[model samples]
Target chain A: MRLPSCGCCAIAVRCRFWESRIDMPLIEVDNLSKTFRVPEREGGFLAAIRSVFNRRFRQVHAVRGVSFCVEPGEIVGFLGPNGAGKTTTLKMLSGLLHPTSGTATVLGDVPWRRHSEYLRRISMLMGQRSQLQWDLPALDSFMVHAAVYNIPKDQYRQRLDKLVEMLELGPVLKKQIRTLSLGERMKCEICVSLLHGPEVLFLDEPTIGVDITMQARIRDFIGDYNRRYGATIILTSHYMADVTALCKRVIVIDQGRILFDGQLEALSEKLAPFKVIAIDLDADTDGYDFAALGDVLAKEDRKVKLRVPKGAAASVTGRLLRELPVLDLTIEDPPIEDVIGRAFGGSSGVGPEEETSAAESQGGDR
Target chain B: MTAVARSFFAFLRKGIAVMLQYRGEIVLWAIWGLVNPAVSYALWSAAAESNADGTIAGFGRGEFAAYFFAMMIVGHLTQAWDTYEIGHLVRSGEMSPKLLRPILPIWEALAGNLSYKITTLAFVVPMWCLFAWLVRPTFDTSAWQLGLGLIAIVLGAVLNFVLNYVFALVAFWTPKLDAMGELYFGACMLWGGRFAPLDALPDILRWLSGLQPFKWMFAFPSELIMGRITDPSEAFRGLGIQLAWIAVSIVGFRALWSVAVKRYTAVSG
Candidate 1:
């Protein structure tokens, strides 16, 4: 006798068969909110003693009415500040948490239900947490992972070899996880998580606490993994380079809500509607009154930087060239970090059309 | 073998390897397991010898030695620390990765529990033999009683593990469970026959012990191995009660685990 493909029934096989026929988002979340009831107490012994009979609690809305969808093979960056619910949302998607309200489906199954099949197809790596046994070698943890995922011996060996080669983990495989450096441990973590070839990957700050060179290497590995396997990845990183390098589309979230979602390049256009013009003058004109052109961001010996509205960038540059002896001139969008800071600071001067609401951003795919 | 069984064995192997790295600490813990039984045996035997008939509560000094010796073995085999461990895992955000696995985290915890027992056996078995030789414990157990006693020990271990794990689920609701863990251990010491034999307890306390599952986990197996439960019918009845409590504990575990996972906030990350 032979087992079914799913080791269950023909109906499940048919369901998979039909699932492949239709084009659907690999992950779909709608109004997914999570509120935590956190205990609160005042300082001092008197307040603490009084709180034994009457305790206080504050409800924290960690993720409120957030919605999003991810297409297959898309590396979407989940950008947010600390306590902005990025990890909370990922935890819910990875089945580590239950939503207070609303629903989410990953690979056509409810995530919080934590079905074995769903879990086998997805992996979430939290940089602060160690999936590997601290006292054991990386290889031991990998073997345990293989057994838990029920990977075939041949496939496990093949994937392990490839991941080791890709992640440069061969030297660290035999070293105890606690003895390894943060970068080596992170590489091992990535290697073990991908041993089973998860279709969906959630990486929360995968490059955190590592050197710039290691962060770049990890970023490159993530990009290569996404391309080679076409795995849909949702990455959260404090490093802008990680997002800008791997994710063509970025989701900006703040205060438990999605502030903006679309192409990474569109972020500046929507949030910071200004162009920076830097000019190198032939001679220093102390009385030129450069502020008359636009907001003089900086004025020095022979170089002047101006922040002009997007609509006035062309005219401002023509005037500077016509009046001043311009040696070289360049126009560029503001840095992504500055734009994000402004957005979070609520000083972006956003219009109704540019203020992409959480609901609107749900469908604002690239 | 099935995938779950394979995973369990792998976890067990890894747990044993981890335990070997902390040999000194484990030796101390194993010694501590012996101290409780040794002190209880010394106290009870001294009291029994003070009696005019060389007995207290129908237990002679040799009988008391046998009882405590059996208690030591049964207690070591049935020990579970999840009630102390789960709170730390939940509070420290360490349980998240374990929960991500396809299998329940309890299987890994159970493997770790067994690994501690298996690794400490080398250090503890010698100590047990030394104590038994020094005390000259009497043994009237027949081969049949020994066979049934082994089965009771296995069942009692399972019952204790399941019950402790079920109680540990309270950590999901209240992560700081040190007080709870201490309270649970205190209850086991009093009601599970670790402090004194159920036979020597006050009539009301002994009657209460019969109604609780702790006595089934510790006293029944220890008594059967000590030849105190001589009647075949009574021994089998004790085994039945152990099985029943195990079944109830497993059911309770299933119910509590679902609610606990939902309640998990994955604090700190």
Candidate 2:
């Protein structure tokens, strides 16, 4: 409702405008699905013995009938719990994996066809894998990358200079990959991946296993690169700081299907529409009947915390102030982690009953 | 053409850097390559000496020695390790990054094969010269014949590369390709003259070797250089077979590569 001011808001507005302006999506996914056949085995040793002679296979639907689209120059967070198909979708989109059914087009080319033109425009960086020639220096790997993408010599040098300066990789570029630390190697990997100047980037847990300082630096570098090059970025990370720091719109999936695909603010409002009210009581609060006012989350010797519906937060505060000997009070939304955890079927946020019903309701939308 | 050359050179440079770190492994593999021919020379030399005519399949003592010594050099020159390398890459999920690249992954193998030969050849050529000094091998061919033999050797190297590449692609469907590799090497050993000269192979195996591509890969070039096949028509026919097999192997490679990539994407997904 308010005019945009912050960098993220401006990005959101710009992304929306571009998304509306373009007739064709830069990345279009239509019911893209992948199913894996895993050999099934029982727990008992006898069953395991039987399985060798008469093997049984089970089908795992890793990515199911899912569809989405991304406009150019947009940063979208693809978030899901482990085994929720985030990485699977990324692989399919990046042409590493072929879908079992349906199709996906990146830069107007079928990803699975793996046209050289299509590949030149996209890059994928997985945290678990290393693209660098391990025995060679990162600089040598950069030249190999430039050759692979056919970047002109002058363009390669200029891009390499900018990346090295931005990533603070001047000192480590000459060292062998085996000699570099994990953070240093990751920085080099990112630099080499971008030297070709791809228009689309699929980053899967790029900051995983790195230290906090390095994680922050990489996140900032990704933002800077995206802004500088107008690259459409799809990122998946377990670290909340990464998602909050970079993505304005998040696509949350569970059980191999999208549960929510919209703004982060809207997700919080829809999933967790309650505020936590904490009051510092003057004395032991055991005597106070706080359960009638709201769901009491915690009751300490001198303070009590209650979860109140957002609409009734002001009334509950007024009643607590008028009736109880409250010294001070504060209201806060539930933590984003808790909201995400609940969305992922993790216990400890919403009750299990509510979590199940909420998941069921959203499951059909896919 | 310039872009292709640049990428090839880039791959070559990076591949050299990688091979340098494995210098120890290169020595061990070179020794392994040499041992096969050395033992064959020893066995076949004894066999020739024991014959009533002091010759087996028209190969006297000097001829047997010359055949295997050339066999060792040519075998090393044309050997391809893509079967094991591609198997490891696919099984360990390392092929993901390669698939993401614009260039086909086969270029990496080709560059690696060339760089490895060049570096180890530093030692291999000296070893060859030492053997030549001791054995005093006879030059039995003209320059034009040697030139044609060299072209055949190059095409033979490519044929071996594509052949091993196609064999390695089977790893995408099955996890274990060790047995397959052993089977392939056994066939090469029997029919490709690794154990003895192709002239020493039994009639059926000789027929089979002539029909297949392995003899062109290993024996034909050595025989051409050693001047065993004196008939010009036979020499030209060998070269023609090498070219035809190279073409066939390339077609097979492209077909298998697409299917293997599809299988990899489907299963590894």
- List where candidate 1 sits over 4 angstroms from the true fold: A1-21, A271-338, A344-366
TM-score of 1: 0.87
lDDT string, candidate 2, B189-214, tens digits: 88788888888878987888878788
- What is the C-alpha lDDT profile of model 1 across A1-366, one tens digit per residue? 122221112222223464555345677777889999888999999999989999999999888777777778999998877777899999999999999997787888899899999999999999999899999999999999999999999999999999999988888899999999999999998998999999999999999899989999999999999999999999998777788899998888765778777788776566678888999989878888878878888887898899889999999998988998999999976665566667545524554344445336443443
Task: Give residue B269's error in model 2 in angstroms.
Answer: 7.1
TM-score for chain B considered on its own, for each of the candidates: 0.98, 0.95
lDDT value for candidate 2?
0.82
Q: How many backbone clashes does candidate 1 have?
A: 0
Relative to the true structure, candidate 2 has a C-alpha RMSD (angstroms) of: 6.9
Per residue, candidate 1 scores C-alpha lDDT tens digits across B36-115 of 99999999988988889999888999999999999999999998889999999999999999999999999999999999
Docking class for candidate 1: medium
Give candidate 1's error at residue A144 in angstroms: 0.4
DockQ for model 2 equals: 0.54
lDDT of 2 at B237: 85
Error of 2 at A278 (Å): 16
